[model samples]
Target chain A: MDTTSTHGASPGAARAALLVLADGRFPAGGHAHSGGAEAAVKAGRIREATDLAAFCRGRLHTSGLTSAALAAAAAAGADPLALDEAADARTPSPALRATARKLGRQLMRAARAAWPCDALDALAAARPRGAHQPVVLGVTARAAGLGPEDAAHCVAYESVGGPATAVVRLLGLDPFEATAVLARLAPELDQVARRAAEAGRRALTEGPGTLPAASAPLLDITAQAHAAWPVRLFAS
Target chain B: MHLDHSHDTTTAVSADAARPDGTRRALRIGLGGPVGSGKTATVAALCRALRDTFSIAVVTNDIYTREDAEFLLRNAVLPPERIQAVETGACPHTAIRDDISANLEAVEDLEDAVGPLDLILVESGGDNLTATFSKGLVDAQVFVIDVAGGDDIPRKGGPGVTTADLLVVNKTDLAPYVGSDLGRMARDAQDQRGELPVAFTSLTSGEGVKPVADWVRARLAAWSA
Candidate 1:
């Protein structure tokens, strides 16, 4: 499934496109966390707006970027098999990797049911065990007929999905404040999506079987410790 | 690949009444309830009962691991492909109630692969009485409470018990041993639901799921019609 044409949708369709992509109802496992906001809260890392912003921003760049890049590449109609390997290499923490794949498989199940595309099967069958979140996102995006930008934003949204939910639960913050946080951060949405799209293009533009690997040990270490805790509110 | 085309009404052994266009949506039903109240048994039984009636699929939500899906597969309740797991990695309530994206995706994928599906059941992992299926994740929901959980469960008035499309009082066979009166539960349920229906069953003995299945079948008919 090397298909790669997006039909050059009109600008007027952009709003609808964003709506479909950003709609919390898209069903890709974004509801599982508060973007590490829960973990951050547990760690005493967040208590107010400014702290939440920084934590969300950092996560947006790390695991968030890794997953988004892979999804974007997938949306571009790249090989899911290749994307899986690439995503696996970038997610080094065993616990985090496992969580990513768990979410990935769950995401795949929903995406396959909602939109029947060869890419979905390709992704599911690509690996003997489990595929990574980015790969699943990328393949699903393509299957859904979304552009790379939509794929890019979808990935960024995943980062926020979990953390945003955590905030409401953790702080008892009103939903209005949460939306305000998201609205103020809207500028970053375009920026992060653009970068993610570029990263995805780079991963796919490389030779077949070639992929990037995880660079941050801090995340892996934190995930390991987080997993060992007796009680944790988030998966990782 | 529209949602309306019906094709696998008879031939497809995997799913008895799947739609024709493989690229369509799965019919989603949700099972939610309190902890240790036979939610797993209900899910396994539904898979067995409906596996031949539709292209059946399941998504299990365990708090920390993919245990429930593993349990069903280990018991051979459904094929490995037909069973997937979602580790909520959080409160079980969050996945089913507040945030439902992951569960929704699983339902869609099952439909995508062996679809157009007749049904896909999302099993909520054991949790407190507050757990209920999100409207986005399921077309209709079955709230499973059991005699073991106590007859007061009916009067507890959680959204799951009062508002779910169908309410199931499981483990009726254990009522005598557990000292629960099914008649009292019926009265309490009636007091809360007004017109919504409730069925009492003992999954351990396979005593009462037929009515639940019939209700589900009727919903599927309406969805496809």
Candidate 2:
């Protein structure tokens, strides 16, 4: 992803951006969430750090696909509205749709002052239309003048980080251990983002690729169960 | 609206809207607080109080459900299509804060679906004291706390109480029943918010949502002006 600065970009600017985007404390409202790890873990889909890694890998394939598609589209500079619909149509379960929108909304907001891109600001104004996190992530990165590679990395890192952050809270895994797991995943992240950025570049000329039409059935069912509860730890 | 102005950030009206562009980009407001803090009720009451005077749309977040949107739809609080729901998968805050793409899309979609709306209310999913909307998400935000959470909640000052554009201490009607003192709560809130406005309401009794709605109206006027 060539964000390494042959372009006058500095390590300080990158660190500052990371502080705003990666710090979980940036006030875009991430604290209330457990990043779906709680529900997945409760459903017995994950058990240990290995399971956590595996679950993240699966997500990189499925929900991860959903998010990346949107990000890639936005990076190619596609229509945010259409990207949103493509995502909405792809996410069938009402629960997942809501989740996407909520996070999508927060991402848009946080990106506003921090990233300060016209696309991001315009997206902020367009609401009630619904959005996908990937598209917003792409647009935000673009707004910040980060190239496709940086955008891809941000998407992959945040996607991986969300669940890992949740696991630390849910399992009381050592923070250092969690950091180790995340650090280990960096290579895979680079691989995924690099591949995706190429795909994104191709799509820029192709006018955007189609998304997977089917939503995961088991995911919808679990969300339904979680929603009906009167008392629960996670908001979603 | 025509949405004539074009920029990378703004995805203007779809190909079909009749109104001209650059006419009006609706004012957006966000409402947030702990769950059961009367967010829906505030939204519902706002619709009832102000719909006739302004064009409005709603975006409601539910962590794993569309229950808030459904509630509005069932009550016919607004047209079925006007109210949209955002699901925050793990943490409600992430949708509103960390990963807000989806919610932004929803708000924009609602504006596009209707036309030239004057206001949009993004209701955050129930959350803890720390939760607050990103200024990027909404032009202004309303943090909802209630007497039931404890009269001390205001005094315990969190960002929601201290920094939100407006603060609503809901469930004021419960004060007598809960042995809570509303005056003390109001004073504590006043101490925390300084020149910012605060309102007390009992959504159940319909005691005081109008002032909050009016507060919203003023901000919308200020934003659009």
Per-candidate TM-score, chain A: 0.84, 0.82
In the range A1-236, model 2's lDDT, one tens digit per residue, is 32223334532244455445556665554554555677787877777788788767666656655566567557556677777877777777787787777677656656665655556656766753236777777776656545566666666777677778788766776778777777887788787777767666666666454443434566567776766665445555
Give lDDT tens digits, candidate 1, residues A1-236: 34432334432234454566567766556666454466567777778766777766777766776677777777776767767666667767777777778678667666666655555655565542358777777666666667667877887876765677678766876777776777777778778788878766766677324332324465566677776765544556
Model 1 docking category: incorrect
Q: Which 10-residue window in model 2 chain A sums to the lowest lDDT?
A: A2-11
In angstroms, the error of model 1 at A53 is 1.2
**Model 1 lDDT per residue over B147-215, tens place:** 988889899887888898899998899999989999999999999888999988877666557767788
Q: Give the runs in model 1 whose Cα sits over 4 Å from its true position.
A: A1-15, A202-216, B1-31, B34-159, B162-185, B188-225
DockQ, all models: 0.20, 0.14
CAPRI quality band, candidate 2: incorrect
